[model samples]
Target: MSPTNPSLSPERVRADVAELLGCDPAEIGSDDDLVDLGLDSVRMMTLVERWRAQGATTLEFPDLAERPELGHWTALLTGSAA
Candidate 1:
């Protein structure tokens, strides 16, 4: 699912990331580089699996690891990225 997919939401993405970081979703900024927040490969792979289960089957670790930004990830997962 993508573009019109209803499974992935920015809030959910933020929460997932926040959970892995052991922080509150509200503390995460959309443009913040998650890698700087300590989002290593292990957590990134976990997100890939989680988003896949949510129907973001197109999501991959490199797609996120390359940029590691919350806003960009939301776009990718929601299929709004250019």
Candidate 2:
């Protein structure tokens, strides 16, 4: 993937989130709340910035923070559910 246009797939989202959470991607269920897993604002902002830099230009902090679920994020990033 290029620096300005990332292929934000479900697996990639899971991997990125899992990497920050210190857990395996498979361990995170689609309905699981990321905040419950210790995801703070700092980490969330990190994702927003990362995804934005990777071409998620319209992604905002509240977009993810409003619903911190794997499936929700997957759809938001990739425009489809896994």
Candidate 3:
């Protein structure tokens, strides 16, 4: 699954995060803090591992935890993270 694929878009990422957190995708944004949403260290680790298995290399648990937002996560998944 390449980032260029529609399945890896920010909207998809947002949806995935929403699903994991049990919230609506509209509730997440590019700057939302994931820790504030009830995602603990364990769950964050699971999410990172899942992303890695799905072919994402730029995103780690720390990065996602630090900036738990759709845009940043999408960039990481797409290999556009700085």
RMSD of candidates 1 onward, in order: 2.8, 3.9, 4.2
- The residue-by-residue lDDT of candidate 1 on 1-82, one tens digit each, is 2322468777788889999999988888888999999899999999999888888776767888888998888887865532
Better candidate by lDDT, 2 or 3: 2
Local accuracy by lDDT, each model? 0.81, 0.85, 0.66
**Candidate numbers sorted by lDDT from highest down:** 2, 1, 3
Weakest lDDT window of 10 consecutive positions for candidate 2: 1-10
Q: Residue by residue across 3-73, what tens digits does model 2's lDDT show?
A: 22347877888999999999998999999999999899999999989898778888888888999998988
lDDT agreement of model 1 with the native:
0.81
Q: Point out where model 1 deviates above 4 Å.
A: 1-4, 79-82
Give me the runs in candidate 2 sitting further than 4 Å from their true place: 1-6
TM-score of each: 0.87, 0.90, 0.69
TM-score (C-alpha, index-matched) for candidate 3: 0.69
Single out the weakest 10-residue window by summed lDDT for candidate 3.
1-10
Error of 1 at 78 (Å): 1.7
